[model samples]
Target: MKIKNITTFLLKVPLGDQRFYSSQCAFPERNSLLVRIETDTGICGWGESGQYGPGEPVATFIETVLKPRLIGKNPLDINVLWEDMFTGIRDFGRKTTGIEAMSGIDIALWDIAGKFYDKPVYELLGGAFRKKVLGYATGCYYRGEDVLDYKKSLQNLKDEASGYIDAGFTALKIKVGLLHVKEEMERIAAIREAVGNDIILMVDANHAYNFHTAKRIGKFLEEMNVHFFEEPVVPENIHGYKTLRETLNLAIAAGENEFTRFGYLELLKNECLDIIQPNIGCAGGFTEAKRIEALASAYHVQVIPHCWGSGIALAAALQYCATIAPSPHTAFECAPENSPMIEYDKNVNPLRDSLLTETFNVNDGFVQIPDGPGLGVEINMSVLKKHLTKT
Candidate 1:
């Protein structure tokens, strides 16, 4: 079937009281750009671009540039379409907004392909390696008042860790690098005390530290038995990543900011990271994510996707996660320690819950893969309208 039209929705959800701080910025609101592609055959699919950059640029790029090329093309030829878009923008749009726009359109095209074949996206990606994947609760962001009272912030973090455990999450990731090294260590200590030893704990610095600072923190994390340390240094510092991985006992994870297979190849060839976190929505969708996964597999690096945004992004991640083969496969690959995991942002976002007709809920530390066709989740148009903003 031929493509008919494409629609883009720029959504913003105010965080108000839920405002939290990462290492680099404060998240006062969550924003997403959703793309809907309708075909002449009456089939439609939904996708989301990454929230890394401004939504308006991504929406505009999709409509003004990519949409024209895809107007009457066959959505089933996803790879060819992806190549065409990627090549057209290779000069100016390789990294951020250009690829991000392509990501949304690529995901929607995959959704259309799956529906056409009467198969799930995972099956289209070469079938499921596992039906469900362990999910880690990604929260413990710094509060506005966190710097004012150290003791109170520590207590707040402890309480938050306990709440995630109560909510059936066995794995948790906390934010760091916003505070002094000593203060952030105390926060980690508090959460570790609250969750105890059995729970899996990870920390994301969000590229806040320099090489020396990250080294100091990495030593402490190794002692704490933290599962992974994410983005300790800036993404540009390939040498820092290599040295950190060599020095630390913990896994060094990054790549959420990375663009495509070409970008990922640099990290892999350098032996920089022990684990690579590629956001499907941002890192070229399923088409390029598959390539990233293969490239990571060759380097023996784990590929655990970084997921944030609305349910459309989450569902796309879940579908992609289903196809990831066990890294360093063993008979017990089904175990959490051996298998890959998906990041489940625990922060408040109505877009994640109310945007889809059937919301995804974590159960016993795992989220079942979506089984319906395409991304396997239906959008609630009313919720879309509620959060829609001018582009």
Candidate 2:
């Protein structure tokens, strides 16, 4: 079917007293830019462009520049359209902004493909490797007053970890890089003590350190039996990544900011990291992420998709997790170890939990994959209207 109409929304769900503070800064709201494509045959598809430090850049770019080019193209010719957009926007956003917009457009096309063929996107990606995916709660951020009070911070960490455990989550992730080394250590220590030995914990610095500090933090995390060190250092130095990997015993994971296969290829060629984290919504959607998985597989690297957006993004990630072949490595396995577990953001978001007809059901820390056509998420227009507000 041909493309008919395109719509965009920049959604921001206001934060409560428990605002999420990451390595960069405190997040005032849970924000994401959603893209919807309606086909000529009356079939429609949904996608999301990841909203991070920058606000609404992709949505505006898509609406002003890319929408005209995509108006009449065949929804099934995703590859052709992707390339057309890739080369056409060289002067502006070929790799960075270009791919970010194309990511949502490509995902919408895949949704159309799945709807037309009466199959799930994972099946269209050569079928599911497993029926369910293990999920990890990504929370434990430093809150408002907790940021200033050590006791309050420790209590917040304890409460967050206990809540995850009580909710049947076997794995959890916490924010770092915003605190001093000692404070970071204390936070991890408290969480570990609270959760006991059975729970798996992961820490993310969000690219907050130099090579030396990254190495030191990584070592500390390893002592606490942390799953992996995420974005420990800035991504500019791929060679530094080699050094970081060698200096630390824990797995080195990054690539959340990276865009296309070429960007990922640069990381793989340098032996820079052990795990590749691709945000499907930002890394050119399923069309590009599938190629990234293949490219990483050849390097013997594991792909643990970085997911923190609307349900559209979560659904896309679930499709990727279901189809990816299990990693042979120690910590990033799929079925048994739940290696590269789905990064389930524990933040407050109406788009994540209420925008879909059937929200994901997380039970005993394992989330069963959606089986409906396309990405398996049926849009809830009424709820969508409720949460629709500008950032």
Candidate with top TM-score is 1
Where model 2 places Cα greater than 4 Å from the true spot, the runs are 329-339
Error of 1 at 225 (Å): 0.7
Worst window of 10 by summed lDDT in candidate 2: 329-338
lDDT of 2 by residue, 229-323 (tens): 88888878787798988888888889998988989999999999888999898888899999999999999898889998888889989988888
Tens digits of per-residue lDDT for model 1, 174-214: 98998899988888988999999999999999999999999
Instruction: Report the C-alpha displacement of residue 339, candidate 1, in angstroms.
Output: 1.5
Candidate 1 residue pairs in clash (backbone atoms < 3 Å):
none
Give the total clashing residue pairs for model 2. 2
TM-score of each: 0.98, 0.95
| Model 1, runs deviating above 4 Å | 144-148, 334-336
